[model samples]
Target: MISLPLFSLLTDVAVLAQHGPSDVLITGLTLDSREAGPGIAFCALRGTATDGHKFIEIAVGQGLAAVICEEFPATMNPATAYVLVKDSAEALAHMASAFHGHPSRQLQLVGITGTNGKTTCVTLLHKLLRELGYHAGLLSTVQNQIDEEVIPATHTTPDAIRLNALLARMVAAGCTHACMEVSSHAVAQHRVTGLRFVGGVFTNLTHDHLDYHGTFDNYLKAKKGFFDALPKTAFAITNADDKRGPVMLQNTAARRETYSLRGAATFRARLIANEVHGLHLEIDGREILFRLIGVFNAYNLLAVYGAAVLLGEDPMEVLTILSGLTTAPGRFEPVVSEKQRVTGIIDYAHTPDALENVLQTLHEIRQPSQQIITVVGCGGNRDAAKRPIMANLAARLSNKVILTADNPRFEDPLEILAQMQAGVTAPDAAKVQTVADRREAIRTAVALAGPDDIVLVVGKGHENYQEIRGVKAPFDDKLILTEIFAELNK
Candidate 1:
């Protein structure tokens, strides 16, 4: 609904390429050429799988107001309007922010980025801030929220146009704060370009998105780019326990702060007791009990506490308020069936580091007689490098391990399972089994459990659908566990 002269947006970085009507009022913006129309600007970007530049001719044929691309497509018509920018994706971000009235500047926006705890940190921020009597907005992989409105999310970080638009809606709804998850893919591709963040939190970095970044250095660079671009006014809070956590803020101009459990830090926490029920932590100087369990939750709690303090909340009040809040959904969500005394934990740990963290946490708290059974899988079309590592970790850490499909996508489910099975060594081979069908995998895990056993279903937590061959079917791990447990008891 924002209308401005075409030249007003194009005058700075764009060069006219066979211009038609430079003063035409623009009404919409998009990066995909398929969405281009008479009054919309099409931003053609070079993506991982394909380049948006190839669809320029078809977009121009549809009479788009302007086609913003890198080289001004090879076949340019004299009557067709075109605006050439140095980088189409980056330009789209700035343009989209402008079109949305720069809502990020209106509210205090905090970006939480890292490999494991981005979702939990942001989710805690939104829920905590709202409970403390402030209107807050959330943009996370689990879902998107504008004050009280909930919207389904298709990506961890949405495209630039949708991202700005969502922020603008939050501003319009009178939101005073916004918490978002900044993915490496989004940062590398400049999806968060031109958005002002008041603060940025680094959870931790690990082996998750190697398929797109292609290398560890490239992945690290992409994460550091967010901190590097941060303004001096913004505060950078990081985990001092992670070796690379301090490295994340090394080049940033932002005021740096650290949070840790391993040693003394600007904001410090000590894990008093890590039980399945909750965690007892000594935060700053005061002892408090929190309902979130595990060492990973300890990191998440510290990050949330640090971020809340930087955002100008009272130190004690933040801890006191946080102590009552439960852990985010499907993150080590524990359930018990009435048939017998057994614990079934549903978590979203998929990466090697994340899986190891969860398994080690279990190893720390599990009783002498309590056994561990794990059902985990790597997603199709994702970091194939982690499949074997995840398999090996599950086999090594659990008394029983079931290899299953998380989301097969386009790859054959059995093929993905076979690749995972290759990681099981001779000693671990007797403990591992392949159940390509995820539901059956869950059922088998539940059936194999004893009175004092725990079944940890990792990967695809909080997700309600199973994606296979580009189609998403209904599948919920928590629901399946409850159904299986109930059916067996009946």
Candidate 2:
């Protein structure tokens, strides 16, 4: 329903050469050739799987009004308009924003980015804003929201066309604030090209997504790119504890601020007590207790508090609402059995740093008599270098370890387990077990546990399906653990 003149969409795009009429009205924008039609402009994007340029002719044949590409077709269509740009993805983003009436400009958008804790930070901010009596929208890995209406999310950061559309819908729904997670992939692919963010938050960065980036430097660059793009009028809040955290703000023009538990920062907190129940902290000289657990969450809470205060909310009110707030789903969630007194923790700690953080937290607070039994796995077709590292860490930290399948997409699950087993040392090898089936693995971990022992089902937190050979079969770690506990009671 949003239509715009083709020339109007090229606001900041650098056109190498353009042909045909620039005044054609474009009603829709898409990169897929199959989605092209009358009044639609098709953007030819280069991707890992395939290039959109190959299907340009097919889109033109489907009656596309405009074609945006890096190169013009060998045989140009006389009726269709042609736009030659350096990057079609970036061009499409700006065009999509223009077509949607620049909805981001109408709302106070905040983007949180880092290897870990992005989901929790943004989710907390969204919920915190709502608790403060403001209509807020959320775009996160778990889901997208227009105030109370939930929309299923397919990607951590939606592509340009859909991203703008979501913002437009939020604007229409009378949302005054929007908080979203900005993935490194989004910055690399230019998915967030034309949006305006009032603030940006940086949680710590760790080893993640190396399979796509190919190097640690490349991955770091991608994360820093988000901060680099932030405008001078915006605020950049970072974790001073992370060594790389200060580096993220080096080139940023935004007002730089920091939050930390260890060193001096713009906002500071000290961990008074960390227990299985919750956390007690002295934040900025005020003593308060938080419902979320672990040291990582302490950092997360500080970042959330810093961003909220920077946004002009009263400090005491933010802390009041934050004390009762819970963590995002599948993040260190606990399920306990009453009869045996065994505890099961479901988490999404897929990376080496995250897994270590959780294990360390458990070790810090666990009773001396309790044994930590861990069940974990690595996904197929991802960074293979981390497979053994994860297995070794699990074996080193837990009393018992089970390596199982975690989304072996298009790869043999047994082979993936083999790679993981390669990391166990000789002394620790005896305590490690390899189970290719994730369900059976969880069952085995629970069965092996005694009274007061802890069982950790990690790697695929908040996911309800197991992806195998491109098929997502029904599977839920929390549900399975609960069922096992119920059967134990019977």
* Candidate topping TM-score: 2
lDDT of each: 0.89, 0.93
lDDT of 2 by residue, 234-272 (tens): 999999999999999999999999999999999999999
Clash count (model 1, backbone only): 0
Put down candidate 1 lDDT per residue, 49-104, tens digits, no spaces: 89998899888888888878888666776755677778888888888888888899
- Model 2: colliding residue pairs: none
**In model 2, which runs have C-alpha deviations exceeding 4 angstroms?**
none
Residue 317 shift from truth in candidate 2, angstroms: 0.8
Pairs clashing within candidate 1: none
* Residue 156 shift from truth in candidate 2, angstroms: 0.6
In terms of lDDT, model 2 sits at: 0.93
